[model samples]
Target: MSYTIKPWQDLTIQDDYMFKLVMRRKPICKRMLEKILHVPIRDIRYSDDEKTMKFQYEGKGIRLDVYVADDKGTVYDIEMQVRKPSDDGLYLRTRYYQSMIDMGLLEEGADYDELNPSYIIFICPFEPFDKGRHIYTFRNVCLEDTSLELRDGATKIFLSSVGTADDVTPDVKRFLEYVNGILSNDAFVQEIDQEIKRVKKLEEERVRYMTYAMKMQEERKEGIKEGREAMQHEMQHDLALKMLKDHKPIHEIVRYTELTENQIRKIAAENSNVSFGEESGRNV
Candidate 1:
């Protein structure tokens, strides 16, 4: 809904479609990765599902923002997260993403060693950690010996745009600024900006993006509404059970718990201990 309310011309570099379109250019993606990882990306290939990808398990779906693999067999999931997920839970989501990507990389009988190295990168406008740093890189290490590495060939990186620390390079800072909508003179960022303009000019692409945005918004709001309704139902069920234990009158229980007469009777019948007490009272 917000995307619809926002002007089409006001779309930022961090907008999901814009992010994908700009990064689809190999040169731009390679440069961006070089800046983020501080290593040269000689050549990189966008995944076949570069624009849109779905990872679903157990009837739940997650759409990957941008996915790619470099010439050296290193895989990257670069996501521009405009909204901070609940309670900075993005880290846990990254863990889930790493597993999902790993599941897709190997064939039926592929060796474990054949699994390509992965980097799960999240570019956020705000600090993911409360700590003041532009970049946070995570890898599994031994708790007893900090020097010991798990060597699992996986890394998760979170980069914030508003960090005040002196840790990021000028180009990195400029790129982050550009993502935040501050115009940049940096060459790599300039190329990205040009691509953004080109993408905005595509009438068909813009229409597709608008449609996808509305569909996702509806799904998200529906999920939230369903979650609230389920929670209320659970609360009512708990209260009904407690009223049954307390030997409350069936009609009173139905009135307070908003349950049907038959449902209240069923709950009261389920608690046979309460029935025994009622029978003893009737005998007395």
Candidate 2:
């Protein structure tokens, strides 16, 4: 026997849902960073507010989807992109964010004696660079000699072509797959069935309100159109009377109003007694 699927059985992009799927995976991210960077993480703090975060580039402001920092003063900016960005675009964002994090450490006139390392981890569904299969880690290097590497400031990690069920050692990979799977699978419908029901009810209510708003807008348009037509008719009538008083030929008034001579003459006759009073005040 086939079972009927309920319409109100889908996960919504609510804050709680996002927190559970993404932010809750902070431990995994911290573990992955520690493994890759070989640094010990004392603790991880996730920022929910966008104001606390800093950005580098212009145009559109970077509202960090998820921002976390390790206890050792190493900040990790992990962003999720549904679509892939170009290599240059990705690097630009990563470098800009990394620079912002570094700049935040020092105050004006203070000696740049000590600064903590920072890492920006970008997780994209689509692969941006053709580096290799699994993961790519990048850092600044001396162009003159391939041997020299800059280890002073920041590092970047890019995870590409990652899916729900892929063999990976890093804890970050597991968390990424889990979240992606939950979003793209029917299991979430089964797991969070009650939340799905609530989301569906809210969606239906929104649709109903939108429908009512549309109807009200249509009615307002119709009223405005009728009012405009009435004003046009009144203006045409006044024009007809003025032309008649000025001894303008009926053809002229008809041409102005796009009305036949009989119509213009009738309007003129109806307002024949009506006189346009002289200007009460003269221009100095």
Candidate 3:
């Protein structure tokens, strides 16, 4: 909550907010996707680009950085992951996002075959899988027979900017290097840099970023408050347990812990090993 907010002027393409803004640009988003996918994209249209998609009866929703669908109905969710997550966490996140995308695309009574092909892409400034490859793409396939492909139409791609292998094209490598804080004259990178500069100068975007920072700070403060309260409650419960173990009177234990008689009774019931040393009928 006490951390400094990064000035809009200091933001780069790697920043989450900056990345989302740049990806919102149709040309940049399309080209970036093409560069990562190594395929030509005729055109792309936004689909729940900024809006968080919520599923029926689901409380939590997913906010995708860039969600778009190409002319062929193939969908894409592109995210810039600056922090390295646990391997399992990252994999589960992609799985959840994939499921959410599917839920958002298919309507009630729609045929299963109507589902469009989709890709969940995460761009990381650090090596994610430690494979030393610029890109790692995943698709479902039969485990026993490696040659057998599932053709599930769902793909998850992780791009590591720190990759050492010469597995990606020069343009892609240049972009990745820029993400890794190495400046380059690549046309796309230059355009993205210009866009970041433009966004920084816009008063409206600056205000938006400020609002976002404030909200994040408030959330952090609230989380800290809740944690402290929970810790205090747990401490009280622990103290009450110790007192009970010491054969302290129920009323005395309640007075120390500030716990209700019924609550203390429940605790005692749960921990039957604590023997009572005093009468149960003590005055409040």
| Model 3 pairs whose backbones collide | none
Candidate 1, residues 127-164, lDDT tens digits: the string is 78878788899999999998999998999999998887
Q: Which is the winner by lDDT between candidate 1 and candidate 2?
A: 1
Write the residue-wise lDDT of candidate 3 on 1-284 in tens digits: 47678888888888888998888899999998888887999999996647587876735577888889999989899988888776578878899999888887775344578788999999998878878999999999899998999987999999989999999999999999989878798999999888888888899999999998788788778879988998998998999889888888887988999999788877878997885556765322
TM-score of each: 0.80, 0.49, 0.80
- The whole-model lDDT of each prediction reads 0.79, 0.57, 0.86
Q: Which regions of candidate 2 fall more than 4 Å away from where they truly are?
A: 1-21, 24-29, 35-40, 51-60, 107-113, 163-176, 179-284
lDDT of prediction 3: 0.86
Model 3: which ten-residue window has the lowest total lDDT?
275-284
TM-score of 2: 0.49
lDDT per residue as tens, model 2, 179-277: 355433443333343344444567664464356446646766776887899899889877877766766665566778776766765675577453322
- Model 3 residue 103 CA deviation (Å) reads 3.1
